[model samples]
Target: MSQSFTTKRYRRYTEEALKDALSAVGNGMGLREAAPVFRLPRSTVLRHVEDTTQ
Candidate 1:
């Protein structure tokens, strides 16, 4: 029997884009809103936001 394994793919984003996303969130933008606008994943943005607040 042969088994196939799947690899998870992650979106590629520039450091500038991430900074912009986080900046938008800091400036009163919602995570959902910032994610799409900055072409970043919502979870990624959320994690950074949470980290900075701590």
Candidate 2:
């Protein structure tokens, strides 16, 4: 027997794009504040901010 797995495809952002999101912070916004502006999850933004490899 074989097992199958499936996952819903979600939007993906590039490094530059993520960088742009962080730009908001540099411009005087909070990390969580920038997340909404970029339409990205706060956790994801923070994770990427803390870990560049994301």
Candidate 3:
């Protein structure tokens, strides 16, 4: 049987972009609130913000 596969493309945010998102959240904005403005996932921002990865 022939099978077809599909892939989902994700947006790659620059370090500066992430920093902006982090700053927004740090400045008292919520994840759900900031994510849409930055066009990123709330969980993604959370991962970068909560983790020590650079």
Candidate 4:
């Protein structure tokens, strides 16, 4: 027998919102603080910030 699995696919936030969150961090807002304020995931914000600085 064979089995198949499905995963949920969706983006709850927009790219503009993500940029705003990153900007907030750039302006001194903590990652933890910026995530919820912009409705973005903390890990996502951290990842982008890390990418840009590298």
Candidate 5:
């Protein structure tokens, strides 16, 4: 017997919201501080910052 594997991709925020979220970080904020304010995961916020810079 063979088993099939699947993965579910995470839902992403809108581009405009993501941009605003990261801008807060650029203005000397932190993921911990920003996440709660935006009601998002810290990792998600950090990833947005990293993605925009690249």
Candidate 6:
């Protein structure tokens, strides 16, 4: 018998793109809606927003 395993990895979102995504959010968009648009998780988008602004 043999055993196999699988792992999931996250694709990196660039800082520049993150900034752009944050800008979109700041302009009055929901995180959930913005996630797919920026190809990022809502949490990631929010994180970038907090990081750069502070």
- The models' CA-based lDDT, in order, is 0.96, 0.76, 0.85, 0.92, 0.79, 0.82
Regions of candidate 4 where Cα sits further than 4 Å from its true position: 1-6, 9-11
**Per-residue lDDT over 1-54 for candidate 5, one digit per residue giving the tens place of the 0 to 100 score:** 987988987766676666677888899988898877766778889876888789
- For 1-54, candidate 2 gives per-residue lDDT tens digits of 987988988777676667888777667789878887777778878887677545
Per-residue lDDT of 1-54 in model 4, one digit per residue for the tens? Answer: 887988988658999999999988999999999999999888899999999999
Ranking by TM-score: 1, 4, 3, 6, 5, 2
Query: Which TM-score value belongs to model 1?
Result: 0.86
Who is ahead in TM-score, 4 or 5?
4
Pick by TM-score: which candidate is best? 1
Q: What is the C-alpha RMSD of each candidate to the true structure, in Å?
A: 1.6, 4.6, 2.9, 2.7, 3.5, 2.3
Relative to the true structure, candidate 5 reaches a TM of 0.60
Please give each candidate's TM-score.
0.86, 0.56, 0.74, 0.79, 0.60, 0.67
lDDT: which candidate is best? 1
TM-score of 3: 0.74
Looking at candidate 6, what is the lDDT of residue 7?
A: 91
Off by over 4 Å in 3: 1-3, 52-54
Query: Ten residues in a row with the worst lDDT in model 1?
Result: 2-11
Query: Which residue segments of model 6 deviate by more than 4 Å?
Result: 1-3, 50-54
> Model 6: number of clashes?
0
